[model samples]
Target: MTALEIKEYIQKNGKIPYVLESIGCSNIVYHDNKDYYSCSNAVGGDCNNPAAINIRNNKYLNYRNYTRGVEYDDGKDLISLVQYNKNIDFANAMKYLHKLLGLKNLYKVKEEKKKPDDSWFVFSRFVVKRRKCVVNDFDPMSEDILNDFVPYIHIDLFREGIIKRTIKKFGLGYSYRWRRTIFPIRYWLDGTLMGYNARSSIENCSEFGISKYFITPGMRKEINIYGLWENYKDIQKAGYIVIFEAEKSVLKRDSRMDPTGGAIEGHVLSDEQVRIILGIGVEEVIIAMDNDVPIEEVWNMCEKFYGLRKVSYIRDKWKLLGPKDSPADAPNKIYNFLFKWRIPYDESKHREYLKSLKKNS
Candidate 1:
């Protein structure tokens, strides 16, 4: 019979037993005074019980959960019922149901399109070739490496006391061959090393065609927060965690995580990362991005954590400090501002802070 004819016959007579017989289903049983159809694909020669459908109530029973049946609407089609019971894609399930009913190619149905093969898209085709620097690979946590490079690091970027404390606390190291300071990125507190962020220590390195910052290739920076592995326990202890842009800011604040620079604009927190923060039982998240970052960019970063409702943006608090200054640049001023406002853990505070800053400026 054609698909249209079978559909019309089922609608008119409601002969579910006959329909099951036509679809090659056998060994039907009646339980709870209800007709139960056997699954056509039942294995072996033993048909223990009816675990396919309950025609009396227009319900479909999954073989996995025979006791609990799913009821269908009045006008639900056979293809959808089969798809639901079989747990297969729409097109393939529809085709299987249609063929089982002895329906020919009478109806015109759109065929599923094949996806394009992405195996041809390789890294070499799109990656730009550049001059490779010979980096000395050493254990990031080795005492010898730490002792070798720590002496060369100067406290020119941040204060002497803060730098020394941060280096010891975060396992910060340096690479003499690369002429860059090393910041180890870990998965959790003392967890596996994911990668490293290397910042050039040489003066005028950018002018000499040396990139100031270099992230390890294949590192999933988009989903990671720098310093989170080390400071998660401290964050739980403090009841809240501060957010910053640069790694140095995380060190300067001593209880914060940086999304590793440039993340404020393009790489905001991912959903998995948010769940990680929530799992840590952090009550509030305060963002203190660079003072030079645009207000719109700060808003974009704030929007990433909008659903959390415990995030507060303190970018406006740093306005009076100066242009392009970060929390690390003036730690005392930022600290004093945070202490004075006592920024509440409210989402609306961000808007209020922005409004007050604009009004005063």
Candidate 2:
């Protein structure tokens, strides 16, 4: 059957439960006289009723209690709903539905178009709005103030010796008046301090309805990856870069950079960022995200870098390790895994890995 024919059948039949069941959605239940299906992929398996599609009206009320209702029309709308709920792309959604219906070759699913270059968007929204630097207004704090703040700020990091090293290596400082620890964010090209990210020292600030993290006025954290400037030389020397999700994770694991803030679902590598990495002659990229990060996210990242660079990821072996744990927690184990997989660290090894990747491809 064609996609249009299948869609028409579903619309006419008006059996939401059957359609959901065909896709292996168990735990289907009737609530409030409406058929609600819970997606296994949903965190905690608590699919809200609003995400349910109404068979009678042929409309998907996705989070309708909070958002507007999206009417289900053709297969495209169904694909969209599946993408929204399952966290997969349109093509994958189509493939999944088709396979479930035992009609694998029924539809020709067009791939989603890539977004336009975001460099200009980022620059206009972030760079142009950056506050002018006042001469001698925001210098680093004095040693005496820093020493006093060190005890209150990241005590665990201080104990582990990472805090002092990060301060020395990245020229991090404490702002006495601001009551924040400042980490200078630099430009990758010239290592110039373009802005700084200030983290509050007060542990309960967030609990008390305060912002724990603050960026320089008009600085968009999403546009730039943290630690990229400081670690670019090491990344070039290593021929591969290890990417983490948090700036603290980068510091803990000695990773090259974290994605602006953290990984978002279905986040793709921006063209501008990819160009910069490629320009730097990075041969491979290893995503070493936290254990709780979904495998789908890892696959999404791999797909973004596919054919452009050799991409691999570190698999979490220990279930006890929480999302906040970094490679520094078990450096020896991570190193052993790298060695076993022959992840490149030097020029010759990089060439070998590239050849192997190409062969496999």
Give the Cα lDDT of each candidate.
Answer: 0.50, 0.49
Top model number, lDDT: 1
Error of 1 at 337 (Å): 1.5
Candidate 1 lDDT over 35-148, as tens digits, reads 433444233323345554444423322122233444433323443445544655333453564566444354332323334435543212111221122111111222222344
- Overall local distance difference test of candidate 2: 0.49
Task: Please provide, for model 2 over 1-361, each residue's C-alpha lDDT reduced to its tens digit, 9 standing for 90 to 100.
Answer: 3233445555556555566555444455545455433333233243444344433324432212112244433212444555556766433554566566555443333323334445633212223323333211221212222333333335545554455555566667665655676666665544545565667777789787768777656543443456776776677667777666656655655532222122211134554344345444466877666666665555555545566678676666545355755444445566446424632233454455567667668
Q: List the residue pairs that clash in candidate 1.
A: none
lDDT of 2 at 15: 50
Pairs that clash in candidate 2:
none
Instruction: Show model 1 residue runs off by greater than 4 Å.
Output: 1-152, 158-161, 255-267, 342-361
Error of 1 at 118 (Å): 31
